[model samples]
Target: MPQDGPQPVERELPTDEARDLLGLVRELVQREIRPVAAEEEASCTFPRETFRLLSHSGLLGLPYAEEHGGGGQPYEVYLQVLEELAAARLTVGLGTSVHSLSCHGLAHFGSKEQRTERLPDMLGGGLLGAYCLSEPASGSDAASLRTRAVRDGEDWVLTGTKAWITHGGVADFYTVLARTGEDGPRGITAFLVPADAEGLSAAPPERKMGLNGSPTAQVHFDQVRVPDARRLGEEGQGLTVALSSLDAGRLGIAACAVGLAQAALGEALVYTAQREQFGRPLADFQGLRFTLADMGTQIEAGRALYLAAARRRDAAKPFSRQAAMAKLFCTDAAMRVTTDAVQLLGGYGYTADFPVERYLREAKVLQIVEGTNQIQRMVIARHLAGPESRS
Candidate 1:
């Protein structure tokens, strides 16, 4: 007979502490996340309490500095944790990634006073965060974002609409990028805007095909005033900050994609083995076995690719190209693997009873988020063949 559930992924952790961390994450997923994931996602319920629990457990800040109330884990270990969480629920996994991405500018470029004052609470004080970059008119061409941040002495007045923001309305804070000078990348600047700012509001969450449990909406900033203290890097440095954050964020998305693919593959294994036809289980059929092998291979390869890129990041090496490659390959692999998983399950896969169909729907968004796969290819090509001539 087939094995019970998906087998635990055997990770090559760097230390005992990392192993223990993964163990705790797995336990938490089984007890809190996986059991209710299907139901809550179907109902479009946000797991606020679950995220609070993760904050209390220090899972939300696994890849940041120790002195800042973070877990001080390396990217390799932290990414593995993301993979485990994502396997249980994409909303939780992707939400955690977005939260980390929201923290990037403040943590990396903020003044010492800023880090000392705000980093701790944001990282571990039960607060959640959202990233604001893509606007309604500037999804791929982020440099063209029209959000305006005009200086009014000590405070800046921000006005614009940020589109497709995860945790849009519910987040405690937002990391916002807006134009501060002339048009294009050089004019943009980053800010840490409180969610309750006077003029900041979110539209109704978009009706998405999947990940309904995590809210994605358009956030409007209408003359929202922010103190200069909230500014992240220097004025006109927003694109630099945003690009750096995206390189790391892409790796997080890659890990999530692998986790999602792994989940679908596990479901396929158990269902095919138990469901029988022609006096035999589906596992016995050579055709199905080959499909299983391909799925397993893709998941493993994707995992390795993301991990390799993560290790490069941890080593303080140039990993932008590798990160883009990981994000591109892993997400595409997830789409293929999840689609094959649905096919392997036959009619049952088409129904809501099994989770494969949901996985298939979720996998598609990965290809589009954190810079679409097309963008990833462009980044890689730029690295290899230099930037395209703007003729």
Candidate 2:
């Protein structure tokens, strides 16, 4: 398998159109994103220009149909673009992933009028979006989210706080999953809430260990009101929409993890060639060479896992299990590869003087977000042994 800098030739690869889109994204990443990546990540600053650039390039709406002002690209192509972005900067990749997740609930389930009214702005403009599913009490158990949305005549009064909301106050809109009924997952409903809605407030950004440029916070919905038309789907379909969206979203995270791993591997390869010990290059050592080999192997495995899952999605096959497996494997690979990249760089890797440290820090969150690795394992195990296996 090819490692670092060049796209590997996989068996039965993407179509010409997909390849073209992938190439376009890579070019944008190299020219526009890579230059500012270090600085923006260091200062915990979101690159608004990057968001605008992507939106203008028709990349922001890649997975949506062409009729909705999107590029009419498949998830396979869209995910490769995400990989390219992650290789350049995790913050951008993650921000894009969150944006796509927010879009998923609406794109799949919104009424025609809702789609016609909102999708144009969402797909065409440089508007950021947030997906609110997690709460202080409900992370893995998303169905248990306490945020309440009570029907009030023609509107819904939303109250309660959502935690770990990506884009938080910065987003132009939010996809909120809240309880409209009394049961667990079955009781939930989803809504497309505007950021400017009254009583919606964001706490100061969380101080995370990595992906600092991607702001996250607790979003409090204090009796915020929205028209019933803003509902994403029927009352109980909220969990359905959220879960299906997460299935696809996991693949996006898998791609991002691969990109991050590839970046770290590239950094390590370059550093080993340049850094010498005892008048010999570090790369010349068998141990270091083996380390690089392992990193390359793990990254290749991750790439294959995600691509297979993406292909399954494109084929409209059942891919939830595959998506969860890919997310778990790739994120774990990222954590290992990035740590090894830092090890290869010696003391310099631990400092901001090199990007490997940042890569390591950025890689850690991949294991935690989208869904925790533990949750991913549960998803995979359930698929392997069937639902009765839980008994």
Candidate 3:
């Protein structure tokens, strides 16, 4: 079963391959993702071309092997890509990250035959994926999700609703978590359902505070039929699948938090350098300088935390606590940094004339999604308590 506790791992700097990946990621962010980010966010546009570009760049499958048309990169490299992409555009970065998470169950748990059949399309194809686990009443308490999948001969009949789903309506496929037994965590199981399934439908996008460019909605499954082969692992393993996927997904959110924080810091730095007050630049003010310093420090710490978690994950070590720590620390740092960035920008930061406001908005969601910060703290506390807490 998926532990509600945090992942524990060590912190270390990136290696040569990680540095090289960051370089490539920086180039891609500068050349492709950055320029149109604001416009896309304003219009809530899903960049189909951008996804194609990323796929062509071998980013869509960064953590997978090349035999499946992937980049054959490590989690560290893949996360650097995510960080740069998020720094450029939170929407696109998040979409890509979530797509990667959606693929986790199938990639790590699927049989070789299943991987052969579906991975290529997922890794190289234009279609994106959505992970369906959180229902209206089951946000942080995912084990209580009411969605159900019942055996129907050779297929399974799934019925329930998943709420606050990123790419809910737009995804080509969904990795759904549904109950298959009496109740609780072990009763659940994971399944891959096509978007075109007969009884699957998505509600109109939710009106959200940020990430407007990425559609968030509720997906309804009314007798949606999926083949037995679509099951990700053995029966009664849905919570485990969900938690395993979340360990990876938490890292994605951490990367996003750092990226958002970096963008805010970058904007604040530019504005402080250029905008003059009292015959001097804002950088001359010790108050503003200290704020910038704090932001930078927090961001660096967050980055360090995330990198450590990534390395532990890549090493196949126990990293659940580390992942939770990264998610919590980075997201909280983003909220602080972005808020400070706005303060550094003065009134301009509050307006649409600048991107700081947008970063602040984007930062807010980072705390709420992928298990809220409250949940993260709970996980961390549990991990800190050790095995005795399990008793």
Candidate 4:
């Protein structure tokens, strides 16, 4: 998902088409999404229709191939779109990232036939998706997930619970991870599961701090049967698929974090300039201006960090470590910047009267999702110092 703050400097797009696409996105956000962001979020309402509208606009499939009904944009372009969405609302931004993550396994690892069969609908068919890997007992240690998917003739029987699921109850489909063999990472396999499959159900959405417009819940698969054709990749290749999805998903989160920070900074700049104190605008004060400067610097650094990683990804280079670093740096920067945004607004930021309060709350979760910042550090350390010492 995305972050908030600061005015977006002019972006450097590679082509006129890319610039036009961004222009459309900005117009859509300004007219449809941003106006209702606060009200819907305060009501904890999921904007299903808005997502459907996004699907119809081809905004949901920007990063996939054009042949499959996708927009075929590079990660560089796709990510800036995410940044713009996040600046409008974190729920919409993170939802877009998670939707892309849900499609990753099938897009990258499915057979040619599977790609031809599934990609079109998944990319632009007005369907929302969720990625299922984390369970109540297994979060960071996804290798130990207990979800089971036993082969049953032409189908597979899935049974388990997935925790912290975004769009858990309302997703049209799920890219699920389940055990199909011996325990540990090797046993896991990815499966495409229809949301309405028999025995599939969702727990109530969790009470969360921010992005209340996005629902998070637990999903249960009780002997849910999926066809063999739905399996993604080889039987034991699920971990590969999962990790690869996360590698890309981490970059999405980084972009969202920067966006959220930028949004928060924008709000702060407006407030400080209009707010009067000591017979002068708050912007005229050195202390708050220095704070604003630091906030702007953090937002820019985070944007640069995520964009650098996006470039590596677009170039087909090995970028997991850089992705991890970007995820870590951008999210941490979001946490700091958004918090400062609230502080800059003083007591008003502490209440629902201002959106900066919401930005701060949303920023906390970025440090946790798509792998915690701690996990990102470990991933980066592994790339640098070699894998963790087992002793």
Candidate 5:
């Protein structure tokens, strides 16, 4: 594969319209996203304008209902588009995924009136969003979150800090999960808190090892009041909403992992082909050739895994297990493939001159985000052997 930039992804689109959509996305990636990705990411600059451009292009809401101003694309189509964007830049790809996850509560469970009132602006109205579930102490055990949302007459007063929140300081809206009852799972409730809500604030962005172009920070809701109309689903059903959103979000993460691996492999292939070792090109050596082959194989495998899960979702099947499997396997594959990429590039790969090193750093986060790979394994095991037995 040529590595001037992102190579064309071999997609299996279902229709001419889907094909056209992919074409449009690729053109946008080339023209708007790729050129500035390295510079912006290096400077740790969040590209809010790029998100706006995607919103205007109807990309931010691709997998939701068109009646609510989404693109109405299937998960399969939407995910391939994600893979393409991630190959160009992870900040935009993963940011769009978080936005989609934040929209899930309202899109799937909000009252019809609420949908009519807010879905339009949210789906494509140039609004950025963040999903708040991880608390400082409750990263993997999300049910243990300490954020509280107590009812005061008609409004719910929220008070707590959400940790590791993507788009934290910049989001126009936040999908917050907070405690409303007793401890454990049933205590949580989901609410859509506008960024301008009283007492809502964000701490400075975290100094992350990668994806600095996408801000991750702690969002503080200090007695923030949310109207009852903003509540999503039934009371004490927030964990369900959060888990369901994560099921889909995991697939998005899987696709992005595959894309990153593909980018790394492409870079490795290009570099090996040009670099001379002894009397021959590095690619001519059997040992290095095997590494390249393994990387390519893993990337293709990851792509297939995520696409299979996406197809099951589009078909309205029970795909939670498949989604977990995809997330776990694809991200692990990405870590392996990206590491091999760095090895193949030798000393230059260790440097920031090439994108492979960045890919390696970025790939590490994918294994942790959405849900840790360990959590994904637990999810898959639960689907197989049933929920864990608590003492």
Candidate 6:
């Protein structure tokens, strides 16, 4: 049989408050998230209520400024909270990360008036958000996005479709990137668009392999008119804003990946210990024990790597290279650890009765999202070797 629940992960927190915050997160996970996770995911039910609860409890905006209705936690502390949430259910964890990503441009680059007007409501109010940069033809090549924003009097008319958006239809707001001048990245600008904009719409959510409880859809902006006041950052700095947000968002994904792998390892350890084979527990065997050790090692290494990158971010240092490395290594580690877990569970692991199978499917997507593992490698390589020559 599977264990009662995932075991607690030991953490080195910076303060007593962070430790207490982790305890509360774990409590919420056990009491609410983990119990209903499998059932809700099976039914593709979005946990809007759980998100509302997180907002009320001040979890939705942990790494932002306290004056903006955020928790004022450092990235190091904030990411561990994400890890705990992900261990219970990835939908909630990744949803929170995406919401934070959506808020990045407004919080960091918007005018003081804009932050004063919008940040508090977005951070802690009962509102959800989506980031809109990926498009049908522009996933990795985000700079090539064709979403156009034409100036119209004091308004901008946006017309494009954003593909693979996390909270596509359900978000209260979207942070959109659109081309306003030249054909390349320099001409793009960011906008904070309300979901109720006149010409905004969303297609049905995609049928995904896992994380069914988190809706992913394509959002359409059919000449939607946004006031100039809603524009974020300067008229031609969208890529800068988007890339900055992604560096932090990658750390979020890395933490979530480590949490997922840790959960899988916990399940494997419990299942193997209880399962018998030839008058001995499966865990007593050397090969399976070695596998379990490797899984645990990978999870720990991934956790440490992401924490290091997060610390760099907290100190206001250049961490783009570290962020890419963490995203690459942690997500790849998650895939390996989860797969090993499924093997350890034998035939039972393949069945829906065991969460290892769901974990395996979920791990696959992490390697693809937030810039694919390939893109991560490319980013890391650029940091090492400089940008590739165009000639």
Clashing pairs in 2: none
| lDDT tens digits, residue span 131-218, model 6 | 9999999999999999999999999999999999999999999999999999898999999999999999999999999999999999
TM-score of 2: 0.96
What's model 5's lDDT at 221? 92
**TM-score, cand. 1 vs. native:** 0.99
- Superposed by TM-score, candidate 3 places the C-alpha of residue 1 at a distance from the truth, in angstroms, of 51
Encode model 4's per-residue lDDT on 1-391: one tens digit a residue: 1223345557888889999999999889888888889899999999999888888899888999998889999998999999999989989999999999999998999998998999888889999999999999999999999999999999999999999999999999999999999998899899999999999999999999888999999999999999999999999999999999999999999999988998998999989988999999999999999999999898888888888888998999999999999999999999999899889889988988788999999999999999999999999999999977689
Q: Write the per-residue lDDT of candidate 2 for residues 250-292, one digit (tens) a residue.
A: 9999999998998888888878887889999999999999999
Sort all candidates by TM-score, best to worst.
6, 1, 5, 4, 2, 3
Please identify model 1 stretches exceeding 4 Å from their true place. 1-4
Candidate 2 wrongly placed segments (more than 4 Å): 1-13, 388-391
lDDT agreement of model 2 with the native: 0.88
Residue-level lDDT tens digits of model 1 in 247-349 = 9999999999999999999999999888999999999999999999999999999999999999999999999999999999999999999999999999988
Off by over 4 Å in 4: 1-8
Specify the poorest-scoring 10-residue window by lDDT in model 6. Answer: 1-10
Per-model TM-score, in order, reads 0.99, 0.96, 0.94, 0.98, 0.98, 0.99
Worst 10 residues of 1 by lDDT: 1-10
**lDDT pick, better of 2 and 4:** 4
Q: After superposition, how far is residue 43 of candidate 3 from its true place, in Å?
A: 1.3
What CA RMSD would you report for each candidate?
1.3, 2.6, 6.1, 2.3, 1.3, 0.8
Worst 10 residues of 2 by lDDT: 1-10
What are the runs in model 6 whose C-alpha is more than 4 Å off?
A: none
Q: lDDT of candidate 1?
A: 0.95
